[model samples]
Target: MKQFLRSGVVAATLAVAGVSGAGVALAETMNVTIVAGHPPVFRWVKHASQTFIPAVNKALEGSGTTIEWSEQYGGSLAKVGEELEAVEEGLAEIGLVSSLFDPAKLAPQNVTYFTPFVVSDSTLVSEWMDKLQSSNADMKAAWEANGLEYLGGAIGIDDYLLMTNFPVKSIADLEGRKIGAPGPAVNWLKGTGAVGVSGNLTTYYNEIKTGVYDGVIVFASAALPGKLHEVAPYITKVGFGAQYAGGFAANKDWFDGLDPAVQQALRDAAEADRIAYHADLDASVSKFLEIMTSQGATVTEVDEGFRAQWAAGMDNVAKVWAEKLDDAGVNGSAVLKDYMDTMRAAGAQPVRNWDQE
Candidate 1:
């Protein structure tokens, strides 16, 4: 069974017997198990440990309630994409639920990926996604439907780069090439003539090394740690834009049972985590690019014309994806339009207005 409040003898005494000074019973202490699929090596997971936990602890200091936190990360408790189920089923109270991996269930969470080349600023993407999750009914329903509450620690992936053994100057160069892409990002290769194979960070390096695929569509923050530059030395700055991979989420039943102060503390801590994660991630992108080049990787940014051509060459996968979701009763078109409109209102200059098309 799911462990909730572990009210020991001390907690019981405090709860039943009113304090001498305040004459009020103390709230029972909570036992919260936080889970994440990614290890501490990633900024998102690191911030969850270093920033979010501490913030929650600090926030609840004088609130008459305390919590015992259990952190299970790096697939120890739940693998990537399984976090939602873990929380929903009461295996964990909270987790870093990756919407990128759970595309079918959390289809609305991947709006940014479906419409790439919109914005490369991780902070911007994170901020806007936080707002959408909080204010948008469709976005919030996605989490609530799964028995989870959206906690707002949005994971913003930096601008995606094409890391390959061969240099790509034009779309024609990708003809017949087997390129690896993560989740919904494979659709970005449509109409470009490249064979987009489904792959992820964990397998990109070995896959490229052993000739499983020629290259991968990846981001710098992850590329540096994975040492992908060593295998795929030609890094093209494709600028697929920052992506909202996922965010912190908690089991709704567990959350609803918590004190209002405790619930607010979790939400506040999530905001803190989002800020710290994005700041660290933003700083790492340029540093990682320099480091990759210093280590003999050739990093080149595609020209504006090339970027435009690439965006133009790709089919309107966003529309197709949104329509498919709408057909399934998720209101995908509304999400797509809202995301694009929100980004534009926030000063983003997208290479292609996916919603317009």
Candidate 2:
């Protein structure tokens, strides 16, 4: 590729087939390190390499500025729960900071988890979170206070499901058993007969295998790839609902120091990542479930009557969630009302009105 260039000089040079004259002068390459707690097997991590890196590289093409990405994924740079701190400390300039793991720092961002049974379309949820980050001052400030930029979007995890070793024909099927859920998602199991265990994707399989828990409330995009189905073949589609669990972010100091064009490219690339990641994720969910069933997992669909029963069985964590943060002065209730209202105005019929009641 460098051979196409007549010289590495920063001056207007002869036009190449794709690059322009102005692009001739800017042959500078900047290195950006990106990390994720989970590895590339997940769609978010995969798109970061496929969609984001290429989009940023393509967006900055003509200007001669190129980003040499040092992508450190799979917990190589930071463990599952430590990604926020890694980016905060600039261990990596950018990362897929799992807000699900850093709930205390990013509580408002977890609104979707609290208000389940709304939108199952993961892409729509991603757009909602993106819009909130841009339109809400409190959402942006939540990240700023933590030394990171929210980047305007998330790598939407597909709708959540209940995958377990035992067949769940009804809510009573899980009575007295242990269910593993990540972060605040544990709250999803509240009021149910099952005990909720705090667990993450990396540990779900082992914990279940070792009998630490009976099953997990997880997403198909991850549960399929992680082979949780092999151990826990009974998958009850409880409609735990999709969520904007985490997203790409940048270290404020490192991001603020970049050239304006580079910064714009990073932001633009993040948008690209958002669209591509969710599109791929939206498509992957059904396919993943099919693949899981084909490989011996029993997939069950909960009836409307049963889904309502399950939702009612859970505590109103959203209310508790809102008031907890409201006391911290984070406008949690406002964010909740805005999110649900936006979703409703967009033609969604939430099974439960989280903010109102």
Candidate 3:
């Protein structure tokens, strides 16, 4: 009886030890909140989270290192204007930021938006951005100074166009017209004689219907879902320049806290998400145009010469922006030149050089 009791005590101790060892070997799980100012319906934010979450989970599968998400869409967490600061302060681990909206924080890199007619293709633009990030340490340092790191980026809506209450066939038609444009887009209206009113996509539908503005500067992909077509049926393809590829940015401190393996997983997921998001966007552009036309929106193709004229008129905003950044003591001029040089090296031809007179 004594021998049997001693054996039972030894067995219990071994079981407890085994459980403790297993716990020690298991990796810790992390919860990351990814915030986007736009609604979930927008492809840039929606598809990124949808595709990225799964890829990350798969990468960490069976490793006991799980990433749970806190997805705040439709400006539920961070308002569109406050995204950069929100992520920097760790309110969100990741965010989808628009450089165009936060030029003060992003500076000369925002020149991409200021320089109209520089990039016509989204794919080439995206590739050029990747090259810029890799080659330009100064650009990365700019984001780092803001306590954020740009992992990768996805394209926003395609080239912007005018969706107005009235048809805009020529630049003369825009004289004194009250046009609603997102903040950075106001530069595109320079010299066009259009009265630029500040607005964002979230309020575009109601503002255009209720406000005194006659039309909005928006892209087809974004306009289709926002139902801007219903309010402004006259779709004018003004050949406005392509926008920068917006994407996943994270709090640098939070990112640095992760294990190296997890860091790589996040980056890989971001890259995959970017590719998938662009594919969906490319398809949606055609589909949205079709839907708008079917819904009685008058889609007019502006003359190619007129498009060139508009591009020429709005070309120098980049230089103006770069000088502003340089004046502020940021390395704005170098960053801008590097980005343009990268685009050129990749066989891209700018409609106009912002650095030139």
Candidate 4:
């Protein structure tokens, strides 16, 4: 048998002893490597191992196929935002490709971040994005263009909020404040009088404590785990809406050449991973808030009037974003309108009609 290499398919024949002593049953064995920039501590990455791999194993039972999996997480194989490139290059068979970090390649996936205050339901955002990838030509093309296949494990981040040292009774308090936001989320801070800097979960704590930033726009699910509440104890619930961060992707060439049963098994496991991740995330949100509050962090929910003021105070970055993508030939305007309309039809009333502007 030829050795299984890291970059491509590795298949072998395995013989299982027959109980009747008539002969040995032959089965196909494949080696698969999964990668993620995030460690297993995150719900998405955690479920990838706890739920996805187990589910795939169960689905492939009795199918004459067995998968040997190698999980390289926490930047062992690829750092944040590089999973797509790694998979596309065949360094790994599959990966939890984070669109939040890879903005240029996965532009359409950031539609929700551009249009905030739409809805805070992570599950809803995950489901709709998955549907769009299957139905929307441009969205599907984004993955195809990169030589990757979307495999259904949608990573839906919880609603975003502000964690600052200073109290935020109104937008006026944010003036002259240096706030850090992730990726396109910096656009959410436009015209708010605060200076927006690009940042991410990995560095938010030390940055805020060291005076690099006065505050950070983050989510509770991550804030608690990241211990961001310890550094920035004043928590303001902005409800910037849940976001579709990314999804599972496989190397196109490798995935396309797999047996149909193996392919279906991977997809089935990805769906299970999505469901388990969202459930874990949803159950943790309020519980995390309570935990943070007990630890002396003050949590405040902005009233409707204040929320409206915050929404209205921003520039129409959504329009700017769409037009920019449209100029790049990605049909950004259509995606923006489609996302906003879908949310509205699902009974979500935005604080500001970004698409309308």
Report the number of clashing residue pairs per model.
Answer: 0, 0, 0, 0
Which is the winner by TM-score between candidate 1 and candidate 2? 1
Q: Clashes in model 1: which pairs? A: none
Taken over the whole model, the C-alpha lDDT of each candidate is 0.88, 0.83, 0.76, 0.88
- Give the candidate order by descending TM-score: 1, 4, 2, 3
Candidate 3: regions farther than 4 A off: 1-24
For each candidate, give its TM-score against the true structure.
0.94, 0.91, 0.91, 0.93
Over 4 Å off, model 4: 1-25
In candidate 4, what are the lDDT values of residues 128-181, reduced to their tens digit? 888888787778899988988899989999999999998998888999999999
lDDT of 1 by residue, 1-357 (tens): 243543332334443365453565555567778998878887788898899999999999977777788999988999888888899888888899999999988989989889989999889999999999968789989988888889888999999999998988778989989999999999999888989998878788899999988899999999999899999999999888999999999888778877788899999999999998888988889999999999999988888998899899888989999999889999999999999999999999999999997
- Cα TM-score of candidate 4: 0.93
TM-score, cand. 2 vs. native: 0.91
